[model samples]
Target chain A: MDVRHLSLPELREVIRRGQYTGPTPGLAPGYAQANVVILPQKYAFDFLLFCFRNPKPCPLLDVTDVGSPVPRMVAPEADLRTDVPRYRIWENGVLKAEVTDIRDYWRDDLVGFLLGCSFTFEAALLEAGIPVRHIEEGCNVPMFVTNRPCTPAGVFHGPMVVSMRPIPQEQVVRAVQVTSRFPAVHGAPVHIGDPEALGIRDLAKPDFGDPVTIRPGEVPVFWACGVTPQAVAMSAKPEFMITHAPGHMFITDPKDEELAVL
Target chain B: MDVRHLSLPELREVIRRGQYTGPTPGLAPGYAQANVVILPQKYAFDFLLFCFRNPKPCPLLDVTDVGSPVPRMVAPEADLRTDVPRYRIWENGVLKAEVTDIRDYWRDDLVGFLLGCSFTFEAALLEAGIPVRHIEEGCNVPMFVTNRPCTPAGVFHGPMVVSMRPIPQEQVVRAVQVTSRFPAVHGAPVHIGDPEALGIRDLAKPDFGDPVTIRPGEVPVFWACGVTPQAVAMSAKPEFMITHAPGHMFITDPKDEELAVL
Candidate 1:
């Protein structure tokens, strides 16, 4: 099945029934996709504070009521424990298990947070006729750990991680303007030309994701990445955490334009 | 002394020294002013979630760390305990005392939250040649309790409160366009032209703040007010709560233009 034309509920149902467990990049193109983070109630305050303090990297979408598997604001009809394509369970900062469903791990004291992802803004950039190198190369966007420090909150703190895309010099301003419309997603570029200014030493290698080509007349534009919260959370070394595996995301009900401001 | 010429730190110092306990409308004109909410650590998470779910009425500016009075993001040099000119201490939803300082009541487990106020966008509206009736009349803006229910978070739920300004019908669209630039403050009008639509019975009788005249050619425009969170928090009847006296806001270091998007 192509699966690209499925409705929001149909797509969630397909994932819920264990029929699909793959990357959700283009499956539901217009809808907003989210990065999931589940933590115990004790650490929920600090983790939320971290996201609030560092909004560029962690634009929070919706937070579930404690111990409930429903993200009330974004997609209340969807069951978080089974709807996502994949889940990574972590214990004491270490990756413990990868599974399609987390019904067995769901506890009464857990809180689920859904954060906005860059996919929303990338769609906007493409619509504006700006090239997104990773989409053009048919691979993951390059991500780098920067020297920029995130504001420390309670038990959460770390350096910001940013995703890099190579855009032609003339189109850089357009890219910034296009993405600035979606602050709910990572809006605007954090850095434009110098990689070393962010203390990122090499373009060929990245702390996460695949490296892509930066062609002539194109410059490396960096955006705050969704991977930041995961890295920061791991650094905190909580007793237990659950997140969507790389490339596996939770699809939301609202269209990408719904997140665009003005 | 004319307080308008004082810098951010100086203005805070004036309030800190108990020399200024009056309403802070025109003083330090360019900088942003914030509504203050200080709650015990036990209720901080729910309140933050409440603010997160409802951005228009409660656009969160910055939240202090647990047991800390310093709002690290907005004004690190100022202390929440003494900077605000006046504070209302509440016990079980009832007003306990109205004082100039909270140091005597401050506890190690309290967290301070700074929420964006309409003052930021009002300046934008004024700069755009839009008439703000309250400022013109030298009185508080009219506020009405709306039928619109805010998306409820855990232990927090209530109707949204809105402040009204009568804009000339010719400038309603411009009013929206001007205010839309600052989402950090109450962004855009929630309703326009009709009070009955928002379940407001009488323009002369507002739930809070003094009602202004609706001129022959003017339309009453309503924007989500900063009072919603305080009203909702009071409705929840937590053990203890502290808030800035209405119109006496916390002055932030950033100017109004800094909150503008695009």
Candidate 2:
């Protein structure tokens, strides 16, 4: 069965029932997807401030109330516990268990955060006729840790992580314009031409995800990556945290167009 | 002395020493001004979430570290305690005192928040040759309690407050186009015509600020007001709070144009 044609409720039901436990790339095509982060209430203020300070990497979509599983702003009817395809439980920066549901680990102090994912902007890029190399290569986007430091908020502090997309030199301007409209979803490129300017040593070897080909006429454009929060967590090492595993993301009810500014 | 010609640091210095304790409008030509709010660290998270949920009314400009007076993001060297010309001290929903400095009132667990003000967009509208009625009349912009409800977060919940401006029918589209660029400010108008639609029955009697005459060819336009947080504070009644007194705003280092999106 084609998952792309399914309604949001149908798609969420399938994921909740353990029918499909895979990366949520193509499912629910036009709707925005989110990167989930659950932390104890003690760490929530700092994390929220971190997102507010470093908006490019951490464009907050919606934050759940303390102990509540509902993301009231983005998706009201959705249950965060079992809606996502996969969940990662982390203890002191180390991955503990990958599960289909987090019912057993739900605590009253846990506050869930849904951050905007790149899938929304990539769709905008494709619509604008700009090529997304990672999507073409059928692999995860190349992510690298940059020398640029993110503004610290309490216990949250780390280097910014960025994702690289090779666009033709001629279309770089258009790519920037298209993505700039969606500030809620990591809008616009951080750096355009030189990777070494960002203190990146090698383009072939990325810190996370697969490296895509950089063609002769293409320019590497780096955008603030969604992996930044996870990378920050790996370094900051909060006592406990939960996130959507790898490519698995929580599908939202709003369409990608709704997130655009004008 | 022409206050408009003073540099940001110079302006700040004058305000710091109590040389200038007047309304900040037309003081600094192009610099952005912020609505200041200081609260105890305990209420910080809920207030931050409230701003996040209600972006239109409370577009966050910068947030200070706990017990720190400097707003590092928007103005690093500036001091929040002494920079703004005047501040209001509130205790249990009642106004306690209006003072020039908050140093004596500052506590270790307090946090400072800088929210975007309409002054930036008003300047933009003026630059576009659009007439702002309040400015023409030399009075405060009229603000009204709207029927629209802001999304509640934690302990903060109330009706949205909006400031009204009269614009000619022909210039309404341009007014929106110009203001839309500065989403960091209030952005576009929430309501274009008919004050009654927003539950603003009589334009002559505003809930706050002095009312201005609406000319024959002009229509009332409402934008989310910075006073919304204060209104919410009035209703929710946090234990202690500090806010910028009316017409007195904190001058930020970044230029108003810097806050605009392309």
Candidate 3:
């Protein structure tokens, strides 16, 4: 079945019923896919501040009401506990379990945050005729941890994590233009030419995801990644944390076009 | 003395000393002036979420650490308790007092939020040769409560409030182009023409501030006002709320240019 033809509610229903358990990329093609983070109410203020302080990496889409499972803005009918394809439960910042649903782990103090994901911008790039090397290579995008420190908010603080894409020198301008329109999703390139400028030693071996080929005429472009928040949360070693595992994302009802301002 | 020539810290210090206790419209010409809202920590999450959910009326410039008096992002060395020229204290949603400084009222649970004010974009309008009628009239800009409802978060919810300016029909496009650059401030007009469209019955009488004349060949253009949050907070009837009295604003160290993009 072509999931692209499905509406957001229909797609969410499939994921909820455990019928679809795949990476949400290219699914519900026009809808925005969000990065998920759930934390106790005690940490809500600091985490919200962290997102506000570091909008590039943590562009907040919608935050659920404290102790509520529904994302009133992004997906009113959707349940945060079961709507995502997969969940990674973290205890004291360490991954403890991976599950299809977090119903058993649900708590009254949990506050869910849905952050804008780069998949929306990637679609924009493809539409603009800019090549996304990782898609062509059929692998996850290359990600690296930079020496740049995110502005701290209470207990959340760590190095910024960035995703790299090789774009032809001429097309670099177009890539920046396309991505800048989607500020909700890690907008624009953080660095254009040099990896070492961000304190990254090697491009061939990324800290996360698969490394894509860097062609002769192309330069590496880096964008702030959603992973930065998850990584930062882990490093803080919070008493508890919950995140969407890797490629598995929470599909939001907001259309990709809704995110584009211009 | 040309207030524009004075640096931000110097102007803030002057305000702190009660030597500059007037409207801040023309003061510190190129620096950003902010609308201040200080609330207790208990309501901080809901209020922050309210600002996020309603960006136009409440474009947050900076939020101080919970219980901290300093606005670290926009005015790191400045003290929120003493920087603003005037403050209105609300107890149980009723205006209890107006004072030059809030030093005596400071509390450990207080959180100060600096919201972007239209002064920055008004500067942009003047630069583009668009007339700001209120500035010319030497009175406060007329503000109206729109029928439009802001996205509610917890207990903070209310109709959006907007400030109106009369512009020549020919300059409406230029006005939008100028204001669009400062989204941190209320970016662009929420309503371009026809007061009836916003359910505002009379242009001669405004809900707040003084009304300026709308001349021939000119239309009323409205931009989201920073006052919306204060109005909403008052309506919610929080146990306590503190805000900058109208006209007297919290001057930040950031230049107006720093808030602009592209």
Each prediction's DockQ against the real complex: 0.82, 0.93, 0.66
Candidate 1 TM-score to native: 0.98
- Each candidate: what lDDT? 0.93, 0.93, 0.90
Residue-level lDDT tens digits of model 2 in A168-232? 99999999999999999999899998999999999999999999999999999999999998788
Clash tally, candidates in order:
0, 0, 0
RMSD of each: 1.1, 1.2, 1.8
The value of fnat for model 2 is 0.95
What DockQ class does candidate 1 belong to? high
Ranking by lDDT: 1, 2, 3
Tell me the lDDT of model 3 at B115: 96
lDDT of 2 by residue, B1-262 (tens): 4567788888999999988888898887799999999999998999999999999999999999999999999999999999999999999889999999999999999999999999999999999999998899888999999999999888999999999999999999999999999988989989999888888889999999998998999988899999998788667787899999988999999999999987
lDDT of 2 at A167: 99
Task: Tell me the deviation in Å of residue B86 in model 1.
Answer: 0.9
* Reproduced native contacts, each prediction: 0.75, 0.95, 0.35
TM-score of chain A of each: 0.98, 0.98, 0.96
Q: Please rank every candidate by DockQ, starting with the best.
A: 2, 1, 3
Please give the distance, in angstroms, between residue B116's alpha carbon in candidate 2 and its true position after superposition.
0.6
Alpha-carbon runs more than 4 Å astray in model 2: B1-4
The residue pairs in collision within model 1 are: none
